[model samples]
Target: MASQKPRILQDTRDMSWSLIPLVLLCLIIAGVASQCSFSPGGPSAGPVPTFDIDAGLEYDAKELGFPIRHPEAPEGWQANSGSRSIITGEEGGDSSTVGFITPAGRYVRFTQSDAGEAELVRFVAGESRTATDTREIDGRDWVVYGEEDAEPLWVADFGDVRILIGGSGDEAELTTFATAVGEAQPLEP
Candidate 1:
């Protein structure tokens, strides 16, 4: 043999070449991470998911065997989410809920169900809440609960059904929504 490289040196050179791709990948990831930014705090503004209120109401009414009211959203209000579920408890029944984003960027949830007042309040608000006051909106009496908190819960009984409206909305926003719900017509099953 004319000249032979040491086996250790040859292995070291091969290992260095194998590490080149991993080094480049690490550098690329660092560059991308350095260019990224995040919000300091608070909720980020983004497109909200849209919910079909009419279709939801129709489906709930037919499936639940109860009238589901279709509230006309206030100007600039958008229905962002909705769902149908059974209220579990001694007074369990079918429940339909729709969440709205108010014009002021606050949230309001409307729940309609055949569940009793206590069950509805517990389900929509919380078990720790208490009835604080009652307000008449659009000729309907709404029992207010947890009014001292940022988001208060309001419930209205309509014979066989109960409607609960609550969320981060203020009194004005809640009133506007309650009025809308009060004026709404039940969807045809």
Candidate 2:
């Protein structure tokens, strides 16, 4: 005679139906917790409203949502336009917000999006890509890209600080530029 107890596979198959409900319950709890913890406007995650600085570019930090900390602008680079502003994406895609400045009389914008940064580098170098690097800043991951014929360089501006340097160029020059730009403020949730 067969055993009266249900087989393990059969029992698991039967219990599978309840898993959906459990997942839903967890999702609901997460949603509610996020709503309670996030900003009143919605799930906001960047910059505190109370942060203020004399030379700081002011914008809706909630919208930019990139973590930066105590940022300082690069030397000889002044805010040209679009500082601390959200640059909307084409049509209805992901938007990138950045602080814009003119370096060496050239328009350069800084954002938190690595894709956008790569695009910008490609545009400047007139190529698709050659190499890339994973960098850590304030314990967060950032990327560096290089082209085949051009000197290796990458740029990222956290908050107001602008960083642009050749990856393989004079190390002293890169250090100078980095130091001149200074460290940026960490983005807050």
Q: Each model's TM-score, in the order given?
A: 0.78, 0.35
Error of 1 at 112 (Å): 0.2
Weakest ten-residue segment in model 1 by summed lDDT: 35-44
lDDT of 1 by residue, 1-189 (tens): 739667756886688998999998988887788964556896578997899887888888888866789988999999999988888889879899999998888999999999988888878765757788999997899999875545788999877789999999988999988998899888777
Candidate 2 on 72-186: residue-level lDDT in tens? 6556544333334222323111223333333334334333332345454554455666547755544434446655565655565443332344433343344444443445445
Off by over 4 Å in 2: 1-60, 68-70, 83-108, 114-127, 132-144, 148-182, 187-189
Candidate 2 weakest ten by summed lDDT: 86-95
Cα RMSD to native, each candidate?
5.8, 17.6
Task: Name the TM-score of candidate 1.
Answer: 0.78
